[model samples]
Target: MTKEIAVLGAGSWGSVLASVLDENGSHVRLWSYNEKQVAQFNETHTNPKYIKNYTFSESITAYHDLAAAIDGVDYILFVVPTQVTRSVARQVAAILKDRNHSVNIIHASKGIEEKTYLRLSQVLSEEIDPENRQSISVLSGPSQAEDVVTHDITLVTVASDNQRAASEIQDLFMNNYFRVYTSDDVIGVEFGAALKNIIALGAGALYGLGYKDNAKAALMTRGLAEISRLGTSFGANPLTFIGLSGVGDIIVTATSTNSRNWRAGNELGRGESLEAVIKNMGMVIEGVATTRAAYELSKKRGVEMPITSAIYHVLYDGADIKETINQLMTREGRSEIG
Candidate 1:
């Protein structure tokens, strides 16, 4: 059965995912909030701003109308930034309510909401009506848009509380170049996806500051330990941290130049102001907001997240990067695994 799917948010990842679905023989309707972007995609069959020099699949159509995008789609894949997810979900829910349609919700965007600190799935559940929402799932791992579009081998995890939904997503997205693994651990998958961006920020900062591979390796290793600690406290399986959504994601996002969070942190370490880095990047850096949320979350949960705290202070509190590193190094030493 060829599934009719609506992909919201025409950013790099969204555009690439839509193209991937089209290549997999699904009819994809890509929705963009920007009318001009929609027109551009329709007229040129490409999104030059995000995915440069790449044309979209002919099976993919672009839409500026939220209702039109949701009209007959069986699944809605949200790829927008986490901060704007609430507003977008409200629009989706309204359209679904009026049409009396139920569709599975799948989100590829990552980041914990700042104030509520809710995962993207939680945000969707709260905004979308239960009757209109069939199930919610998340697709996450080390896959990057640039690499995926070029037919590079990519693997990701699709997780949902509903096993059937997860399996369906895995089937929908799996292909010769892309592989999908199914997991029932929604909490662990989502947290690993969201939290790894924070660590990537630190990793990039270290790189920008002229740190070598040894420092980067240590940051990633210790970073995973902290991520597991916080994630376990919130009812996630500790083993999930060692899997694709955890270590796999950290390795990619921390090291790759394709990561916006890493780029942002790199710029910050290279002595660029946060405002300038954000303006220059021309994309949402999920880690910036995730850092703030994780910092607050660590305090509220009484979970020790020293690396997250150091990055937060540097990014938010105007702490010097060097001083922050010094502070982290001078902290009381403890066991490698506590």
Candidate 2:
């Protein structure tokens, strides 16, 4: 049976996911906030501004109207930026309430809300009424849009407290090239997904600052340690950090130029102003905001997230990058396992 799916957001990741669903023989309606871009995508079957030179399937339809996109869809995929998730969720919830409809919800965005410090799934639960929410699941891992579009072998975890919902999403997304795994550890998966981007920024900064492989290795290793420490504090399974969403995602994001967070950090390390980097990138660098949220979370929970703290200082406090590195390196030595 063909599934009717509405995909919110038409950014690079959203567009690519819509295409993948189209390939999977799903009836996909992709919604974008920008009307002009929606029309351009409908006409050209391409999103040039985001994913250059790649054409979407003709079977996929683009929409600017939220109601029209969600009309009669079986599933709704939220792929908007993390900061805008609450606003979009409100709109979606209102529409669903009015229509007396509920659909399975899947969120692909990765970031914690800055002020509330809530995970995307938590934010969705707050905005969307329980009666109007069928089930909520998160899809996260190391996969990149650029690679996935080319049918590269990619693995991701679909996590939800509801086992049936997680299994359904895994079936919907799995293919020969795109592998999906199911995990009940939603907290671990989500935290792993969100926090890796922060470390990716640090990795990129190290590269831009002319640090060698040894430094990058140390950063990622210690980054995973901190990620696990904080995640487990919130009742997450510590073993989840060694899984795909944890170590795998960090490896890809921290090293790849395709990561917006990494690219933003790279620019910052090369002496570009944060404002200039944000303006030039023309994409939401989630780690920039996630760093702040995680920093606050660390302090509130009294978790020692030295790497996150250092990056937060560099981004928000305007601390010298070299000096921050020195501080991290000179911190009192401790055991490898925290």
Candidate 3:
């Protein structure tokens, strides 16, 4: 049986996922708010603005109207920016309430809510009416759009407390090139997803500041420790931090120049202003906002996140990069396992 899937937010990642779903014999509907982009997709199956030199699968239809796009679809995958997740989810809920439909909701975006400090999955579940939501799951890892579109071997994890729902998502997305795994540790998976972006920024900063491999090695090693500490304080599984969503994601995002967050951090490390960087990048660099969320959450939970603190000060408080690094390096020592 063929499944009908509606993918919201037809940006680079969303477009790539839409293509993958269509290739797997699913009827794909990709939604975007931009009418011009939708027209471009329908006419040429190309999104040159965001994804250069690539053509989307012609079978995947693009929609400008949200209601029409999701009409009768079995699954809704959100690739929208983290900041607007709730508004979009509420809109989805209103539409589903009228239709009396329940659909599996999944998100590929990573970031914590700036104000609420909730995970994107939590935000989605809170907004979508229970009657209209079959389940809320998250797809997160080091998976990149550019690589996945070219049929590069990519592995990701989908997580939900609902075992059946998690397995269903795993089966729906797995293919020869793209492999999927399921986990019940939703909290850990999400924390790994949202928090790793901050560390990636720091990694790129270290690289930009003329630091060599040893600097990056220390940053990542200690970075994972901070991520685990904060996450476990909030009821996440410590082992999840070692899995694909945790260390695997950190390895890819922090080290890869393809990552928007890494690139932004590179610019920041070279002494550019955050405002200027954001203007030039023209992409949602999630790590900036995620750094803020995690910084605040750490204080509230009394969790010591030194790397996050340094990045937060640099990004939000206008602290000098070198001074922030020096401060972090000189912090009081503790046992490695502490």
Candidate 4:
């Protein structure tokens, strides 16, 4: 039996998911904020804006109408960039409330809101009604849309407080090219998803400074340690940091050219100012905002995340890259294994 799934945003990640869901035999209604993307997808069955050169599956319907997209939807996938999640969620909630129907929401965006510092799941919970909150979940990992859309083998995790809902989502998205794992520790999943991007920026900065693999590996490993420590302080399972959403994600994002954050950091390392790098990317490099949020989160939680702090300083406080690297390297040495 096929399910009706509505995917918000028609960017690379959103389009990739629409293809994956349709390939799994679900009827997908993909909404695009860009009228051009919608027109292209509707007319040519191909999204030229993000995932070009690949046709949207015949089972996937592209839409520009919010209400029409949510009509009789079983599961709603919010794939919009992290910055716009709250706005999109508010719109969806209004539609759901007007229709007096609840839909299971799975957000694939990865970031902490800049001003509120709220995780994507928390943003949804606060914006959506209590009834809708019960069905919210998050899917995140090292999976990139460019790779996933090409049918590369990818592994990701789905997290929700409701185990049954997580399992249902797992069944809905898992395919030959993709594998989904389930977790009930929503905090660990969400924190790992957001914080890894900040660490990725730091790693990219290190690479931009002409650091070797050993230095990169050290930064990534220590970054994961601090992330786990901070997550554990927030009542999350520490072990999840060692899983796909944590260390696995950090490795991929920090090292891959496909990572916008990494690419942005590389430009910064090459002596470009933050403004120039962002203007060149032409999309929200989530880590820039996430670094600020994580810095605040660590201070609030009383957890020490040196790498996050360093990255935040470099990006926002005008800290020199060389000085930041020296500060990280000169920190009091600790035992290798935790």
Clash totals in order: 0, 0, 0, 0
Q: Write the per-residue lDDT of candidate 3 for residues 6-72, one digit (tens) a residue.
A: 9999888999998888888999999998999999999999998778899888899999999999999
For residue 310, model 3's alpha carbon misses the true position, in angstroms, by 0.4
What tens digits encode model 2's per-residue C-alpha lDDT throughout 1-338? 99999999999999998888888889999999999999999999999988888988888999999999999889999999999999999999999999999999999999999889999999999999999999999999998998899998999999999999999888889889999999999999999999999999999899889998999999999999999999999999999999999999999999999998889889988998889999999999999999999999999999999999999999999999999999998999888864
Error of 4 at 328 (Å): 1.5
Candidate 4 residue-wise lDDT, 1-338, digit = tens: 78999999888888898889988889999998877778878889987656668877777888999999989989999988888999999998898888888889899998889778787898998899977544989999989888998889999999998999999999999988899999998899988998888878877777888987998888888899988988888788988999999988998998998888888988888888999999999887889988888899889878888888988888898889898888877889888666
Better of 2 and 4 by TM-score: 2
List clashing residue pairs in candidate 3.
none
Q: Estimate TM-scores for all models.
A: 0.99, 0.99, 0.98, 0.96
Model 2: per-residue Cα lDDT at residue 278: 94
Model 4: how far residue 7 lies from native, Å: 0.3
In terms of lDDT, which candidate is stronger, 1 or 2? Answer: 2
The list of candidate 3 runs beyond 4 A from truth reads: none
Candidate 2 differs from the real structure by a C-alpha RMSD in angstroms, to one decimal, of: 0.7
* Candidate 1 runs further than 4 Å off: none
Displacement of residue 293 (Cα, Å) in model 4 is 0.4
lDDT of each structure?
0.93, 0.94, 0.92, 0.88
Alpha carbon lDDT at 157, candidate 1: 96
lDDT, candidate 4, at 329: 79
